[model samples]
Target: MVKARSVVQRIHLLQLALQITFRRTPLGVGMQNECWGAVAAELARLRGETVVAYYGISLREFRELIKGNKLTPAVMRNRVMGFRTLRFAVEV
Candidate 1:
């Protein structure tokens, strides 16, 4: 249980970090190809895993969503909440 909770915490931290980083970085929030690429690379490096596999979202889809101006703060908040819920479940 402890190990599971640790893993959950790690994942939650990773998601929060990514969310903060992306929001604060002009390149990341702007949806520039280079920015998304950099974000994906950074995530891979930080998590030591492929970004698509870890996030369940492809870079192309992310770029398209950004290009379409479909990204919203509500969606991001929901994702954070979802991860928090996962972390809480593991703790219990």
Candidate 2:
């Protein structure tokens, strides 16, 4: 019984972590906005494109992408790192 309770607790914690890491919230809104803004600005400068496209994924889609069995951790890390690099490059 004790072991089962402990397992349940761990599962709950994992779920919470997944939510925080994958979900878009006010907590990370500023960083997200700044990153996308920098990307848009740089793209505009390079291609003279006045309108930038931001693809908004529905909650279900986001969860599917982030939590899908086929998506590896490395892929997710690369995506996040790439975004950060783009943001930094544009700022410089």
User: Top model by TM-score, which number?
Assistant: 1
Q: Which ten residues in a row have the lowest lDDT in candidate 1?
A: 1-10
Error of 2 at 8 (Å): 0.2
Q: Estimate, for each residue in 1-92, the C-alpha lDDT of model 2 and write its tens digit.
A: 11122333333323333433453421212224423223333444465533212222233432343333223344354345344323322331
For model 1, residues 1-92, the per-residue Cα lDDT tens digits are 12233454446445644554446423334435434345544766687866445544445644554443324354353344334323433443
My TM-score estimates for the predictions, one after another, are: 0.36, 0.24
What C-alpha lDDT does candidate 1 achieve relative to the native structure? Answer: 0.45
> Which number leads on lDDT?
1
Clashes of each: 0, 0
